[model samples]
Target: MTPPPEDLASEDAKIPAPASPDALRDAILSVAAGDADSFAGLYDATSARVHGLVLRVLRDPAQAEEVTQEVYLEVFRRAAGFDPARGSALAWILTLAHRRAVDRVRSSQSQSDRDVAYESRANTQEPDPTGEAALATLEAQRVRTALEQLSERQAEAIRLAYLDGLTQTQVADRLGIPLGTAKTRLRDGLLALRRIVSAPRQRKEE
Candidate 1:
């Protein structure tokens, strides 16, 4: 056959510096049994690749640092479970790194999805309408005055949910209020908006 592709030869050449599975196994055993230098060497050998994997999944430098630290801690805690006969030590570390990266990505995605839903929910809730041009202008002023009349916590909840496009849950979380309290604040704020808009006309008629 013609010579294999040069790139394939090059790829094979780039394989990690050969690490003897037997030596790795001995190191794991040595570290688990409390040979401090073996454990330190373990950190020296694996940190770069583990950190790369963390940064890929987290896409945040700070989070990558935290996650990498967690990976090393986990390795130290669970090293006794390593079964060297089944595979290479590097393979084990790589597997753990892969799992941790996937977990971090999934968590980030979940939070992102929650934030989007909250935004959509906040955008959909509203108030009332008016009759005259004066009524409309007064309605705008009343809406502001109504909002201003609320308790600080109540006003914040309404602003977050109505003006700023946050979910009730998000408002509650941001304001440190209970979920039931957030709902009650929103309801009360809307009620105040109605009364304020109607009050000027009620007074003029009288």
Candidate 2:
């Protein structure tokens, strides 16, 4: 079934404001540099959605919880592997969550079944994108529209890296492109989206 308009509007509400790239960079640096509290902050910042993605794909809260830990462990273990050039730290962790969830789903069941499950649960829960400040949903829609203007490949790469939980290598593997191609697509895609998001007034003026 198609998502209800309200659901789409609510979906718009969950993406949050642009995380301070500098702050996020600092967090990743902390983790990479061995500060435990910084690592905890990173986990706390992203765990819910990661858990939600897991549960959506697996439909098991217990398994989702386990996967959540696994996702973070991987994040901590692979902190050095994170590529800030591609996107924000949050996007990196989210990509891990999505890809891990995808792996669990695909490893056990048919892709079609997993997609159906993912879609069914998606409309039921809304992601609260606002970290603290109150931003109206209408403004969120405007941002979403701006994001829609990016090249499809760029957008796809971002989704794959961030939402699908694939590494740049895995993205290249899945897309049948070279690692360099995946990296380029991921970077260009995020830059395009960032430009659209950063210049909201420009888009509005247009």
Among these predictions, the greatest TM-score belongs to 1
Candidate 2: worst-modelled 10 consecutive residues by lDDT: 1-10
TM-score of 2: 0.45
What's the CA error at residue 44 for candidate 1, in Å? 0.4
| Candidate 2 C-alpha RMSD relative to the actual structure | 15.2
For each candidate in turn, the TM-score is 0.48, 0.45
Enumerate residue pairs that collide in model 2: 16-129, 95-165, 99-164, 99-165
Q: Provide the overall lDDT of each model, using Cα atoms, as 2-decimal numbers.
A: 0.63, 0.63
Cα lDDT tens digits for candidate 1, 123-176: 665424436556847745655677887778767776776556566567778989
Clashing pairs in 1: none
**Shift in Å, residue 150, candidate 2:** 48
Worst 10 residues of 1 by lDDT: 1-10
